[model samples]
Target: MKENIHPDYQPVVFMDSTTGFKFLSGSTKKTQETVEWEDGNTYPLIRVEISSDSHPFYTGRQKFTQADGRVDRFNKKYGLADENAEK
Candidate 1:
């Protein structure tokens, strides 16, 4: 370990912009804004656009689209019969 060679790893608060969720964690990221947490401590506030709170995958709101390729799209667009539909 070298002296003054590592970033200052300290407690950080990540705020989800959409869900307004905040959690405390450790990081070396710097921030100019901060808010007092429930524990009566002020930590670095890092506003994030997406987090587990508002993420579609985490919130069970994600949509799964099956890709059938361009051929399937062309067939469906012009009402062309699908060869696979015969089976």
Candidate 2:
């Protein structure tokens, strides 16, 4: 509860470099850049490499390989499918 001991926590604008997505949030990090927000006010601007707007996981762009299909392919490659069927 000491005064003047905590860093400034203020509204800042974070912009995604790839997707050009911008959001306003409170952050203690300081930046020299400023951007005017929709509220007609300027805030510190921070550029980020990736954000939820452009992330593969969030954007549903991630590739998911089916394990069952892979196993079937491997079995066919080594002719194991026929051996299992005979057993």
Candidate 3:
């Protein structure tokens, strides 16, 4: 309820590098870079490495790990007959 107690919340553009997806929202984050948005106005540009547009879940590029070969490698190195023996 106090006047001038909160930081300024201005229009911000979050740019996703992988997909070139820009998200416009109100935030208090400060930035020195500016870019013209689709709204024909310049705002602080925040560059991000990953976003939903390029993420594995959304783009279907997820990776699966297989431990089947790891078990054999461990047994061969440690000379253990039972690979799943107690540590």
Query: Taking the candidates one at a time, how many backbone clashes does each contain?
Result: 0, 0, 0
Cα lDDT of model 3 by residue, 31-69, tens digit: 999999987999999998999888999899998876669
Q: Which run of 10 residues does model 1 get worst, by summed lDDT?
A: 78-87
- Candidate 2 lands at a TM-score of 0.70
CA-RMSD of model 3: 5.0
Q: Between prediction 2 and prediction 3, which has the larger lDDT?
A: 2
Give the winner by lDDT: 1 or 3: 1
Clashes of 1: 0
Q: What's the lDDT for candidate 3?
A: 0.89
Each model's lDDT comes to 0.91, 0.92, 0.89
Worst 10 residues of 2 by lDDT: 78-87
Sort order, lDDT high to low:
2, 1, 3
TM-score of each: 0.71, 0.70, 0.70
Model 3 TM-score on a 0 to 1 scale: 0.70
Question: What is candidate 1's lDDT per residue for 1-87, written digit by digit as tens?
Answer: 889999999999999998899999999999899889999999889999999999998899988776888888888899999776865
